[model samples]
Target: MKYKSFAVAIWGVVILLVILVPLPTVLMDILFILNITISLLVLLNAIYAKDALSMSSFPTLLLFTTLYRLALNVAATRLIIGQGDAGKVVESFGEFVGGNNIVVGAIIFLVIMLVQFLVITKGAERVSEVAARFTLDAMPGKQMAVDADLNAGLINEAQAKERRKNIQREADFYGAMDGASKFVKNDAIFGFITVILNIIGGFIMGMMQNSGASWNDILEKYTKLTIGNGLAVQIPALLISVATGIIVTRAASDEELSEEIISQLFTGPKTMFVAAGACFLLTFIIGRFFMIIVAAFLVFLGIRMQDSEQEKIKQDEKEMEERTVEEIRKPENVVTLLHVDPIELEFGYGLIPLADVNQGGDLLDRVVMIRRQLALELGMIVPVIRLRDNIQLNPNQYVIKIKGVEVAEGELLLDHFLAMNPGTAEEEIEGIPTTEPAFGLPALWITESQRDRAEMLGYTVVDPPSVISTHMTEVIKRHAHELLSRQDVQTLLDNVKSSYPAIVEELVPKQLSLGEVQKVLCNLLREGVSIRDMVTILETLADYAPVTRDTDMLTEYVRQALGRAITKTFITPDNSDVITLDPQVEQLILDSVQKTEAGSYIALEPSVSNKIMQNLLKLVEKVAQLGKQPIVLASPVVRLYFKRLTEQTIPGLVVLSYNELDPSVKVRSIGMVTCS
Candidate 1:
């Protein structure tokens, strides 16, 4: 761990030194050899790797190794150009390895380039792309199968969940490999560039220095050395490319590639006998004594492979048994259960297609839009929703949950449209009678054929997804208060600190706790006033928090700060809102109120509470008839208590404090809540 932390810094320094300064011949020679050795080690590991994900760092490793090779090329080029020789390694390559012939060395280089660039690199890239596409495309179905097994009792909940997680990991692994393959392609291209620079630059230096006997002498010496240099680099590169090609194109096998090939190619003695006969015939026809020798070797290898495989199986079984016994000895209470997802949507088998992206389902996309919308409208960063299928549900039913607790649920007809009755219209549409889950509005679930007819009859037509989305929206909005934690408050403050740091620093801890601010925001959300304008809300808290630490009173002041935003959203185009709150009824409620540190509530007589409830419910009906949101404007002192009272009877009613209204917005008189 300590070494890895400093590895990048050390490499960075090495790269700078290699590029900026010339190195001694002996040191340069050692580093070059080290480079080749490391490349061989990486290549061998890639070949033996059983899974692509095991080589997940291949792309990053490719970049560093490629950089190191480039640096080595630069260092070696300087050494050879400055003097007649580079190092012992380069001298040996030019004399012994190249056979002192440029063409022989050049042909070796060309063959390595051709094989790595055209054969291995291109094939690996194509395999990566196709594998990525197929893996991603299969995820939805794979997840659905896991859900099926869980619901059918074929597997327990834990087993099915583990399978789903593995499927996701596999998809991610292939996707990463698709991008990593590009590094190998670029590395091959760069190898060609490196060779040209060395040869061209070396010749110019040799001629310019007058350190050679003649032009021919200079040409021959440099050509041998350059090709030898190219040979040293290209061999390892070719090996690595072949290893990469092997890793990306193979299927997952229980054994290593060599083991699997040996096991399958000559699994039984019958195949070995056939091979021995063929070799025996070759020896009789001509001087092919080696063929008979090879046949005997093949027969021996076949018998040995079976014995080795049997021993490996027994060893594996013994190890697995020991591990199982060790695991079983642990107490059952020590095993941990899974953590809960903050938001989850579970649908039944019939509704699986609605969440499957491959089948043209846009529900998941719509979920992205939902989070964006809430952030815009409510100033809240909603958590990611986990959408999965559940066989435990009825075919058409779905449930929405918060922290693993089912909060809201609804049913959808996959092939039908929900046509809701627009209250102003008297006409009735024929279909399956039902009520909208979000608001309990009178609605009918009609088939696709009746959609146009229903619209023609003045009904508001909506698709199944839209119906569910609306319910999801409302359920989330209604529960937004509970969702706001102290952490959520700190997040809001931190966001403000980015744009308005001084304001948050001065207000929090100095004036009130995070719980206090969270309470203020929750109070506003409970009344349907959007907290989207967080800047204003926080500023308002900062202004009055020092004077009074009461969250309820502070929430009222924050509401006033957000008056413009609230009125713009709730008021009509003419900037007008209709509300009812008779002063006499308000006074009577205030008179019955008792104050506490948290807030105040109306504790009226049973008869008085009854009178207030009846009139409020009547006013709600009246406002509904006028097609306006029902609101009751009151003093801040009584606003919170008034809301508590109405929620039990007329839950959709919007109760606002008078100061919450913007001065510029107009108000119209509606039915006043008088004690009738």
Candidate 2:
């Protein structure tokens, strides 16, 4: 293994020597043979490769081989023009391959050069250029596909990473080939020029050195050697050119090139019989015995192939029947149906264009972006959203589902723009009025011609795709807690464990079980907190886990630990308007608290609970009147109980604890919720 590199280094050294130093004909002959062998091997390897990436280094190899061949050409030129004798390889090629006739040898050399330079090299170069361009263009779509698969849990992180790496490798390989192809192209040009210079220079040198030789004698001798040298070098170059063409044009397949060609070509036995009949008819004019034999062989092959194909089809059908019967008999087959997707978007047939890429529907791309947006905002991976067409719905209607149950549904005017009055619109647009599905704000679905006028009047305009994407994004945020499972928590833990090993090692399994950790994280997500900072959450859990395994209490500690983030969420720098809980009301809630093995809750009488609810509702409405969100501020101990008390009656309300606020933020108590 160590000497392998040493041997390659020596090969490079030898090429350099051939270019710069004069060498013996014996060494020239050997190097000439080596070049031919390498070229043939490269051609064979290219043919056998299952895919272009299998020979990713071929582009670089193309450069080395071109240089090596050119170096040999220079040495052969030196021997021919300066000494009038290149080598045995050149001499034999000139005499034997050329049939000892200058015209024949020259014709043979020209034919090889033209075929390689014009046909194979030209086509390979063009293919390389196109392949490189297309491969680079497709990279982003391929990367997103991997991400979609990973998010859907179809593949793990490691597999996703490997796929991404391969995508990069493929792009890099094609790009290099695009440039390396020029080497072969220019090599052919240089070979032609070298041959021309060699013939003219050899002729002049031969005549000048051999003073007694006639012009005919000099021309025949030098031309034969020159043609021979060109033939030997051009044959290998032709092989390499063919290899370049084969590699760049090869698509990924399970079988080698030869096998794929044979299988695909002979797929229809009927075509073979038709070709045999044509050949048999041609025998009358072209050849009698020869064409008859060719036609007979084709007929025999076709008959055998047709019989084999029929038998294979019968065997396949029998196996498929047996498999189907076995599957139907097994009761365990029902287990597959029990699994449900975490999220799904089903639309009517008329709205299929929105999810179809062929029709310019960017809905699938938008779904991928929605997953990314939620991951960034909530610090958790969003589940893959399944998109399917549902026939039972209205033409323009779509429904969003969580765990196989519909939670939200909306309708769209596919060819119109959704324009919402941002409260500053100069005038109402003339269009069909509707409510924005995401936030339930009043909007108008205006035609394309009315879009500019709507925007000019200060309305917020969005397309149909954006409407659904925004709605889906908001829904995912609201129910992110439900979508997160124990498995998701473990995945998150495994991700951060690499950077914060001690925090995770000290906190999970030892301090709290996976389910307990999952509950605490779920609680945070339920209240809308970004858990992107896993280190802090785990550290807080480790510190408070031993004292209380109560998830609700542990969540409170985690909130306080993430106080800065929580403060940023609710408290703006200029205005922090919040309703405060009265000390007496807080004391009353504490007094009515009840605890059980399951958990704790308030055991207050209905009348007492009703009074607190009425006061809280009045305060919440009062804050809304001031053009600010209604946030209830309470002491750390009373915050959780108050939130639970009001959450069902007043959903989407913001509740915060005093400890969860950063010390730098100032709070203004707009109103107080009290049971006086």
Candidate 3:
């Protein structure tokens, strides 16, 4: 650390000297000696420490030092002389000015340019690190809380954890890559411009001398040049630094750095110096004191910008907090049932637990009672229902078998049924209503075959018509309640409905056509819907005479109905499941795949799937020719196919499923663990 700091300090002093002095032969010799000494020390320290010497600070220091050396040379020759022999020196000076000024100026400009380039490049690296740190810090325990909730069965653990990890890893990788790429490109482009500026400055200086201006006159004229011109060279450097700072800071909030702003900062300095005479006139009266005032104003601007940025950050944080609070407080009309083992239920899938069934029963009872009240007003019959003793899974799907009927099919519907009570808009079913009047109702039907199967399982079926009537009423009431309660929810529903009418009203007989309604309905279906209510609504729409005959009208109506059903089922469940996977998992998988391709069969440490192992082997086969090697498959719950393959002793297929692999393999695996 001490050595590194020393190297940086030496570099800084060199830059300071160059900025304050000019490059004479003596000064150049002195600079060469200084550079050699510092370079040797840096190399020695790097060798001793067994680390790469930081290349980041070198260019900036070198450039500034060159500038100071050049300045000193220019000032000495221009500003000092005796009266009589001064003319002889002046002629010598003119020769030097004509021939050497451009070269010296170019050298100084090149150095400063290089320094700026290095600063941008290295600064980006530092910025990326800061960005990653800030992003990690900004989470404020949210990820941990999400993990805890998942573990506690408040959410789906596997899916949520996977998603969370994915999100974090993606964010980290993108942030680092973006920062690095952007900075490198900007640095290169700016460095090129600096080279051009140096060439221009050299040309201008040579021109002044060729016009017979004395060194003293040139110096006096320089002093008279505008403060803006004096600042022009340094302004690009300052602006670039400020931009780098902003880019680094913005990454904390996950916002992107603007390329336009960076470009403006780089180009602004050169453009400012286009009219040197005008700048000189302004500088003569205002002098350096005015430059000082501008500097002070810039400092003030920096302070104000910092304060504004900080306040904006605070406001955003406050809003996020409020949103989080609102989400937590938002009434959950649905209660999720988890750890469902579809295999146990004898359904093709899995079974939800007995405890979840009991909770479902209680919720069902409340919904039924609400439906009964609503049905009385609608002149519909209310079903008298009793919760059955035995729970059976629907053979066709992992649906809950109540009495003889499948309460819900599909993972999506089952999830909704478990989480939401009937009569809540939050749990509306999705997707089935567009093509058929039965919509999602078929999913809830208790077929005669299903009833007989349920009876064998020690359950009895309730009357179908009564159950359907009661269910429909409950669903409607729930939807109405939700629409009345939530502003955002209501707005979304209204938005979908409003689009068709507005389209018709504005473009009737002109651009508005039946196609517009179809488009609107398609959009709504894609969004999501309540399958249960959608089926009922579609049936009701069929009964309405006006919608029954015209295919276009029916198409639009069906589409909207399907959308409503889909909305109820998909939207509610999605909101509740917000877990994301760690990025390392994907990176690890990708790296492992890459290595295996390079003639090495690699075993992945225990993780999410058997697929990762398969991918590793595939990658190895693609990259190199290897004889059949025992590719160990290490993960929890070894697949039956893998076990069978291992037992057969098949060539190119040796599967060892265990947590502890051999030491040699373990070392190899470390190389496969990727970092972005």
What's the number of clashes in each of the models?
A: 0, 0, 68
Stretches > 4 Å off in candidate 3: 1-5, 12-236, 244-249, 253-400, 403-676
After superposition, the stretches of candidate 1 with alpha carbons farther than 4 Å from their true spots are 1-338, 423-427, 574-577, 597-599
The better-scoring model by lDDT among 2 and 3 is: 2
lDDT value, candidate 2, whole model: 0.91
The C-alpha lDDT values of all candidates are: 0.79, 0.91, 0.38
In model 2, where is the ten-residue run with the lowest total lDDT?
97-106
List the candidates ranked by lDDT, beginning with the highest.
2, 1, 3
Best by TM-score: 2
Best by lDDT: 2
The RMSD (Cα, Å) of candidate 1 is 17.9
Clash pairs (backbone) in predicted model 2: none
On a 0 to 100 scale, what is the lDDT of residue 66 in model 1?
Answer: 68
- Kindly indicate the candidate among 2 and 3 with the higher TM-score: 2
lDDT of 3 at 291: 57
